[model samples]
Target: MTRALPSGIGLMPVRRPDDHRPRLDRLSAVPITDLARRFSAATPTSARDLDRLDGDLMLRGFAPVGTGVLRRILSRPSFFWMGKSFRRVDDELIAGHNFFTALGGSRGLPFAATIGPSVVDGRPAVRIDYGDPRLAGPRLTRRLYDELREIEPGLWLGPGFLRIGQRRVTVCWFAVDSSVGYGEVR
Candidate 1:
């Protein structure tokens, strides 16, 4: 039986890949979206093209590790939301993303992201933007562009700024390998 989906942002075509289907009996009761988001991640190839990325780091934002009081402030008060998995399919990049709710809880919101390959300041980079049906009216969701660069082997970084309402904050964006926190997330 097909259920008519509720209208809102971040809901997509739920025709997921085989790797995204169920496997764990322990988690059988969990919603398919939650389960799929956790299991659907891929790792990026160490190449210069965005189209070639099969998967990449599921970025978890920690305490802002940079200069300026604003950067610290932007990251401190809000709880961190991490996207554990990202994969490329037919030129589209899909992320298993979680978001911080204003009430201090976090939830996963599946959405499509657009990544453009380019050179920024002579460094290999890709410009990333969350596509339409975005999280609206949120401080972190509006007015943003993520510029991710290949910093090292198996490492990518997004040097981005976010505008929340009227205030803007420089965001610390970078993702480590999925194995970095395997025990914690898995």
Candidate 2:
């Protein structure tokens, strides 16, 4: 019979020593050689691209774990944008403000212009437009992630844990193509 340790001591019964071994169950399926090969082959120009690709590949390769992490990051309330120009009403609206207005104005038609308050926030809130319709679908998001990965290799990609508002959140970055688009990730 084994003697019980004192209550104050941080000692617990050891069942099987082998049972306590770190399990690599989830990591086992992924071939390290293949991953290393792919990583080595990748020629990302910047961190952003690397991050985007990392997130995409992680999601595709790991499924539930990848997606679960992404959802947590994106769902954070604090990950939103906020401030003034976001709510400013400009009298002389630029052509790029609205494609419809730009086209109509160019055709010598009077177009009404208005400004409304908008919230902008996220992991990298400065670069994203939260209300964009293209960002509404997962497929687009994934595609964006892939494109960014290729274009900006050095950016933070996704499928990783982040501490946000006292909770762990997972976030990802992706790209989208729009007829009325402006600016790059930098």
- TM-score, model 1 to reference: 0.44
Task: Give stretches of model 2 more than 4 Å off.
Answer: 1-41, 46-148, 151-163, 166-168, 171-186
lDDT of 1 at 173: 43
Alpha-carbon shift of residue 69 in model 1 (angstroms): 6.4
Per-residue alpha-carbon lDDT of candidate 2 for residues 96-138, written as tens digits (9 for 90 to 100): 1111112111111111212222111122212222223322333
**Candidate 2 local lDDT, residue 111:** 17
lDDT of 2: 0.22
Tens-place lDDT per residue, model 1, 38-141, is 32222222233554333323343322443445434433323243333455533544333433433333344333445544322333345444323433334445
Candidates' RMSD to native: 12.6, 25.0
- Model 1 alpha-carbon drift over 4 Å, by segment: 1-48, 51-79, 92-111, 115-124, 131-142, 163-170, 179-181, 184-186
Single out the weakest 10-residue window by summed lDDT for candidate 2: 80-89
